[model samples]
Structure formats: C-alpha cells, structure tokens
Target: KTTTAALIEITTTTATTTKTTTTTTITTTTTTTTATTTTTTTTTTTTTTSTSTTKAPIFNVNMLNNGDAETGPCETDSNVMNPPGWTCNGEITQLAYNNTFIYSRVNTIPGTAPGGCLFYGQISGYTSMWQTIDLTNYADPSLIDTGTVEFNLSAWLGGFINQNDRAGVSVTFLNQANQTTGSVTNIGPVTDTDRGSVTSFLFRQATGFVPVGARSATVLVYIIRAAGNVNDGYVDNVNIFMYQ
Candidate 1:
C-alpha cells in the first residue's frame, strides 16, 4: 500500500554554467623628438679724399723800380747825389733835362726819354750805380727755374760831342748766395762815333732768356772817361722788363 510510501520522486536536475571572461589590454606608447638651429650676418664701409693747389705764371711786367728816373732831387751840380732807386759809387747825379743846363749840354734828349730827369755821371774815370731786384716778387720760383722768363733790357745811352766818354748798362743774374749765375747782358756805351759826333742819345735794346737759379737781378749803370775831366756818360729811360 501505501508502502510506496513516499518513495518520493527525487528529481535530480544538472545545470550547465557558461563563464564570460573580460580581458584588459595595456598598449605601450614610444615617442621620438628632433631639434633645429639658425644663424645671422653683418657688414661695414669707409671713405677718403685728397686736395692740391697750383699757381699762375706772371706776364708783361717791368721788374725795375724808378726806371724812369723821375723820382729824384734833380739838379745840374748836386753834392749829395741821391737818385731814389740806386746805390751809387763815384760821382753820380740826376740832371733836369726839360729846361735846364743838361738840355743845353746834350743839345737834345731823346724824345723817348721821359721829360722829367736824366741820369748823369759827374766825375771822371769809372762811375757806377746799381740796383738789385728780387725776381721772386714778379714771378714764381718754378717759372724762373724752368727758364720761362724772357728779359727785355733797354736804355738810351749817350755822350758829349766828339768825346770818347761813354755810358752803358748791364744786367747780371744772381743766385741765392749772391753769385753770378750766367753771362752778363749789356745794352750800350753809345760812342761819339755811333752818335755821329753829336751830343745826343741813341736807343739800345737786348733780349734773352733768364739764367737758371736766378733769384735776384742786378742792374748796373756805368761810365768811363776818355777825353773829358767830367764823366759824360749819360743815360735816360733805362728799363728792364720780364714776360712769359
């Protein structure tokens, strides 16, 4: 009967379990770095200059002072003989020619002679007067050194009637040491024969190149007595000129 008693029906059920796995992935990161450089430049500059000077050459000028003999204490018979521009030796005087004793003695002064006065030799024998002109005053040293200067020496030289007494002029170029640099240049000692035995003057002139190294020039007026007690060497309008 009932002994079936509760053989209870034990129903054993087996369940299958499904497992889900969560995987965490860690990724390693690697980084690479680089560097760069820059450069600069500069520049500079400069300048310079120079200067010089030059002089002009001289032309057409008379280098002698008082060449006309007009500045004088003019007299026929003067004791203190002083012609304004010359250093004199022996007896020398200035004679008034326009209306004085000299005009009567000379008979005629040249028309070219300046009307004021004349140079006279008052004593017998050798008589001389001179003047030194500084050439640098008229021309540049380069002009004189290179012989670019031309000289014109001129005078009216004369003597008394039929006498051997005579007058002459000369120019001597000198160095800085006062030594002669070249041959002397002379104008005239117009003789009584050349003057036709008349008491009058005759014109004379000379032209030439200036000597080298000539810093100064000396003008000499001289007289020689041949037949008279008084020196009859007469000169008028003596001149020295320079030109390029």
Candidate 2:
C-alpha cells in the first residue's frame, strides 16, 4: 500500500475612507456678506488566506506457495496447514510427497458410496480414500474484500473413467465485522490426461452483486467429481491474492 499528500491556497482584499469640515467665525465679523463650506473622505482595506490536503492508506495479503514451510503446505498437520484468516473443514489431509491437500466428500452426500466425493490414493498396490471437506470452514462471505478476491488455482487429475467429471473452487464474502455477507461458486471440469501433472484454474469474484460493507472474504477449493463413477483428482499450488 502507498499514500500521498497535496497543498491548497486562498486570498482576500478590502478598503476604507474619512471626512473633515470648516467654521463660520469670519462670517460673524463680516455679518451679511460671508459664507463657509466643509468636506471629508476615508478608505479601509483587509486580506486573508488558508491551505489544506488529504491522503489514503494501503493494505495487502498474499497466500502463495514458495517452498517456505511458513508459506507452503508440505505434509498433513504441517504447522502451515491453515494460516491466519483461514480454516479447513471436514476430512482434509495434506500429503507430504507433493505438498498437496486432499478433501474427501464420501458418504457425506446421500446415495454416495465408499468414496462418493472423496479422493483416493494408492496404498501398497491397493487404494486409500476419504470424504470431502466442507468449504464453510475456509470461507466466510463476510470476511472477503468485496473488491478484490481472486484465486490462482491449479490441479491434476489422473487417468480415470470420469474424464468429464466437474471440479472447482468457491468463494464467500464477509463484512468487516466477520459476518456472512454473500457467496458465489466457480465450477469446471478437469481435462483428461494420461499422466498426472499440475493443471491451471483461475476463479475471481463476479463484477455484479459484490457484498456490501465487506472488508475481507474466504475462498474454498474443491476437486468435485460430479455424480458418476469413482474418479479422483489431484490438486496443488492454490494461490490467493487481495488487491490494494
């Protein structure tokens, strides 16, 4: 953030005047033939002035991955799991191998089976899976900066039958007092790939319907598997930035 100041000026002016007179003593001695006259004038003036100016404050916050333990998530339960102004809900586990976090939604939604909306990983030639996490813990509509909420996200989806499966992130706005202000969702599907690797996804707050009196907000990223077969996705490098 940055700030600057300016100067102003003012000016004024004024004027004034005076008067005088003459007597008739000679007219008294000369009786009938004498006369007298008198006259006066005056002027006054003044001036005044003043000056003033104004300035603004700057604020910024960056949630990015830079390999720093304090700024990146490398393992489950890592000290950097949830930084300031953020929280996690549900069964979200951070993986140490690639510094990625996985959320499972299995069994949480009705009709969903063993790994309904969850992520599964290889376990000794077998497989391990868990349920999805709720975004409410990460985003509070009331805390979002109504003017600047942008998400620079990326993920990877390994070979699976559900290639058309949808997955994405969501953001909620909150007021300065930390109350729910509004909510919006960003949805998309992962592109099918033979080998798993990082893929990019970007989500920003919509132009219209921004929250009122909101100073900040929360963002939640999810790898959704739109109802279908048991398809799992890998996610990484989720970046959050706020404009000044």
Candidate 3:
C-alpha cells in the first residue's frame, strides 16, 4: 500500500513561453565646383609725303672778248653795222643812226668813241631804243623750280675822257608765249673813262617774274642811247644765273 501512493505523486508537473522585435538608421554626403574666363586686343597706324625737282638756265650772253663788227645805214661806212653772228633789225636810221645786234658787236661810232653795242633792238623814232630777244625755247618755266638772275655792266660816256655820251641798260623777263612778265630798267649808265675805261655795275636784282601758263621763260637785255651827241660807249662781261 505505501509503494502504490508514491508512484502517483511523481506523475504530477512541467511549463514554457517565447517573443521577438527589430529597428534600422541611415546617413548622406554632397559636393560643388565653379569656373572663370579672360580676353585680349591690339591696334596699328601709317603716314605719307611728297617731293619736287629743278633745272638749269639755257642761254647766257657774255659780251666779253670783242669779236663783232657794225652793220647799219646810220653811218656812212660799213662800220655802222653790228658784228658777225648778229643782225641789224631796227630802224635804218634814227637818233644818229642807232645800230644793234645779238651776242656781239664792234662797239664803235665816230664821236661815239667807245661805242656800246646794242644787244637788243631799239624803239624806232624814240630818242631811246628798246629791243627784245626770244628766250622762249631756252627757259623751261616748269623745270625752273626757282632761282635768281644776275649780270654786270660798265659804260664809258665819251672815250672815257668825258661823261657826255649818255646810255642805259636794263633787264627784262619773257614768257614762253613771248609775253613780258616783268622788267628792271636803269641798271646802268655808269660813265667810263679812257683812264677808268670801265665802271663796274652789278645786277643781283630779283626778277620776281613768272610766266602765265608757260613752261619756259627768258631774260632780255636792252641798251638805250640817250645822248644824241657823244663819243662811243662800251659794254662788257654780261652774265646770268638761276638762283634755285
């Protein structure tokens, strides 16, 4: 009986229980960039100019080295005419038979001792004579550019013994068209003497003459015999220049 009661109490007891839960977290990052630009420039410049040229004179008459003779109707003898290489183009007889020539002459006339040759013509009938030479072909006005003309004259009135025989010389400018541009008179009448056979006269005068629409110009020489009664006068050493 005691053994049966102990087995029944041992069959008596056992018990068990379970539960689960979850959670999560996150992080982020960012980046930025920038750019710049530049520019350049340049410049330039230029210039210009002009020029000109000149030429020389063509004709020059130096009455030096007497080599001319006289030819005209004024004197009773052939001695009244201009020398060779010259011409008798003025009045046949006026104011004691005036004679003239170009380049050279004998410079003789009785009572007119030391006669001055007429390089240019004379104004017919007038007490004084006026003559002109053609300088058209010689001067190139266009090529002249610029310059000055000059000359020298020495006259002896009466055989260098007296100053009674009066005379004068002048300079004139001419154009290609054979026209007068300007003139300078009374440059000389300087009395000469046998002892002082020649008096010096200088002409550095400016022509200040221009040719109208012409490509050339000329220098004219005029000799005037004023006194009707006197010994012959003489002219020597004529020259000219282009100043430019």
Best by lDDT: 1
Overlapping backbone residue pairs in candidate 3 total 29
> Ranking by lDDT, best first?
1, 2, 3
| Alpha-carbon shift of residue 68 in model 3 (angstroms) | 8.1
Model 2 reaches what TM-score against the true structure?
0.36
lDDT of 1 by residue, 17-116 (tens): 8787878787878766655555555555555565533356556666777767788567754443657888988777777765344567754555455466
- The backbone clash count of each candidate, in order, is 0, 29, 29
What ranking of all candidate models by TM-score puts the best one first? 1, 3, 2
Worst 10-residue lDDT window for candidate 1 reads: 50-59
Query: Model 2 segments beyond 4 Å from truth?
Result: 1-61, 64-86, 96-166, 182-212, 225-231
Quick one: best TM-score, which candidate? 1
* Model with the higher TM-score, candidate 2 or 3: 3
Tens-digit lDDT string for candidate 2 (42-136): 55555555543222222133333321113334344222232222344432333443222332222122221122122222111222121222222
Each model's lDDT comes to 0.80, 0.35, 0.35
- lDDT per residue for candidate 3 within 1-244, as digits (tens), equals 5666455556545544454445555555555555555555555555555554333455445332232123332333323333233323332222122433311223333333233333222332222323344433444455442433333333322222333233344555555565555444334454443325432222222333333343323323234444443223433333333332
lDDT of 2 at 67: 11
> Model 3 Cα displacement at 153 (Å)?
8.1
TM-score of candidate 1 to 2 decimals: 0.74
Q: Is candidate 1 or candidate 3 better by TM-score?
A: 1
